[model samples]
Target: MDKIQHRTIFVNGINMHVAEAGAGPAVLFLHGFPELWYSWRHQMLALSSRGYRAIAPDLRGYGDTDAPPSSASYSAVHIVGDLVALLDALGLDRIFLVGHDWGAVIAWYLCLLRPDRIRALVNMSVVFHPRNPSRKPLESLRAAFGHDYYICRFQEPGEAEEEFARAGTARIIAKFLTSRRPGPLCVPKEVGFGGSPHTQIVLPSWLSEEDINYYATKFDQKGFTGGLNYYRAIDLTWELTAPWTGMQIKVPVKFIVGDEDLTYTTPGIKEYIHGGGFKRNVPFLQELVVMEGVGHFLNQEKPEETSAHIYDFIQRF
Candidate 1:
């Protein structure tokens, strides 16, 4: 395998720490919330060894990257702009894009904002559904997802910021790093979010005390506020994409989700998604792969399967 190297790239006036390697085509990997570029360790090495240039960045407010304080700064348009600027900084006009969770959201928007800059896209976990301008504000969304409404709650500023600092951010970081598989308890049950009670869930076999400690230490450097800012962008995201509302994605795209992912089980979900949502969005969409035993954190839980699928997809392109 090719050795990975670390470097910081300045984009959008903020310096982002990137882990990259390989020598052929450029593939930028964008990580999800609560995770750093460290999450893509397997993909970086595997893709690099296969003669593909793989790059993973610690996004604007995560990891070793700069964390600006304004919620306005973290909106989809701005985040997407950051990616474009990153490409400019790297002297690349276009590249393959892969994103997970919040990264996926940004990936979807990036394709919408600047199709010329994206060669193809792979969005995992989070599906791209355009914003509903007619929909009610946060409360309606909260009602839809319930206690799983943490993302909506995160819009409330100060709540997530103070909670992490006060409730031992270390434990919060440990909860995510130690989780091998997605559990029902990842969010609070009182809000009807998915997962069992905190005590009922079992830690994944893969997580070790040291792994948890490492993430916790990183979280200690910056509070959860910066991470939470991503959630504060709903309105801004909606307004920003107003022009692209019925537009279909022209780039080659795929959606990968785990069967056990709670997203599939949400009530009235299919209709909501299919009713002029994602299905109407990505026209050139290639495939949707639902792995049987995997959960939300598929990359971490089943790295071999995830990497194999990713490699297979890229080969076809």
Candidate 2:
């Protein structure tokens, strides 16, 4: 891990923290919620050893990066703008993009907003949610999953943060990182973000105590507000992304998801992926792999397979 290089570069009006290694073709990684560039540590080292320059950023609101106070600042446009400027600052014209969870959402938007800058993409966990012109994202999620749903529960400001604080930062991080349930995560007002406090959580083999400490120490300093703000801006991103309605993700792509991943088990998601909808939208999609028994944090849970999957796909382009 000490072999990885860290630097903060000014981009898009904010100071962005980036971790990079190797000296060949660039591969840019985008991490999801409750995570930082540190989440991509294994991939950075693995891919770098394979002669690919791997770059992962702390993004705008996580880790050492600047977190703006306004929810408006966390929109897709703002996050993508930060990345576009980061690429220019690094003197790169194009890169192989990879993302997981919310990072995957941003990857889709990046492809939509700046396809020219991406050589290819390997997105995990979340699929491209084509914009629905008739409804806002929060409204749709509420109607489909109700107020207790995690995303819906996150809509209100400070409520989730208070719950996280009550749960304790390290415990909360452990719960999210070790969770293996395939069902949609619902944090009811009564249950809160940490779920039942009496319920014990067992750390999985893939995640070590040290790993939790690394993430917890950062979340401890930065607080959950910076990360939760991403969920807060979903509807606003929907409204701002109207121009991308019905647009196809034109880049060559590969998508992989754990069969037990929450997004995979969401209602109708199987149909969407296997029933021609996904292919129709992402015309250039090269492959889709569903790893059995793996959960939401696929990369962390199965680092070797995940890194190999990324290396195999990106090397083709």
Candidate 3:
């Protein structure tokens, strides 16, 4: 980690903090919610040592990046614009891109919007879902998972933040990072995101107290609203991206996921992935890996294997 270099770059109206290591072909990493550039620390270090430059940015509304006041500001178009701008600012034309969770969603959109700017992509956890032009994203999610589903629950402004506040920042961070529970995460109003202040979340062997502290410290200062805003803007993103409906991602892709991941366990997702729907949407898809027994945070949960998988794929390019 000491080998990594940090800097701030002004991109797409926000000051994005980027962490970089090594000095070869750039491999950019985009992290998901409740995480920071720190989420890619292991990958950054491993890749750097193996002769690839690793870049991980705290995306807009997370970590040190500027948080716009409106959820509408977080549309996939806006976030992808930020990445394109970041690449330009750093003079990178196209690079191998890696994304997880929300980052994976954004990466899919980025490729859809501007494939010329990406060499290839390795997306984790989330698979690209072709846009349903007729229905808003929130509506579909509400119908499928019900209102209590985490994404649906995060739609209302200030609601999730309030529960996060009451639950305590670090506790909530620990809860999210350590959760191995499969299926859709539905936080019923009665239970809250923080199950109980007294509930002790046993840290997984892969995640250290130091890692949780690194994330909690940042969220403690930045607040969860910026990250939650991603969810809050789902409908807007859906509407804005209506034109790209049915557009297939052309870039070569390698999709990896933990079999135990909530997204993986969600009803019909397995069918979607293995049932040929995923490949239909991601036409250039090269490989699909389902890591056994791993959970959503597969990269962090199994850094060595994850990093090796990453190295093997991107090195070919």
Candidate 3 per-residue lDDT, tens place, 61-153, comes to: 998889998998999999999999999998999999999999999999999999998888999999899888888888898899899999998
TM-scores, all candidates, are: 0.88, 0.99, 0.99
Between candidates 1 and 3, which one is better according to lDDT?
Answer: 3
Q: How many times do residue backbones clash in model 2? A: 0
Ranking by lDDT: 2, 3, 1
Worst 10 residues of 1 by lDDT: 189-198
Candidate 3 TM-score, true structure as reference: 0.99
lDDT agreement with native, every candidate: 0.74, 0.92, 0.92
Error of 2 at 284 (Å): 0.4
Candidate 1 colliding pairs = 147-191, 148-193, 184-194, 184-195, 184-196, 185-195, 185-196
Across residues 151-228, which tens digit of lDDT does each residue of candidate 1 receive? 765666886666565546656665554443333223553423222335443457655566566666776886667778
The Cα error of candidate 3 at residue 138, in Å, is 0.5
Error of 2 at 46 (Å): 0.7
Give the per-residue lDDT of model 2 (tens digit) for 1-317: 98799999999999999999998999999999899998999999999999999999998889999999888889998999999999999999999999999999999999999999999999999988799999998888889988898988887788888889999998999989877666677767887778788998889888888999999999988888878888999888998988889999999999999999999998999999999999999999999999999999999989999999999999988
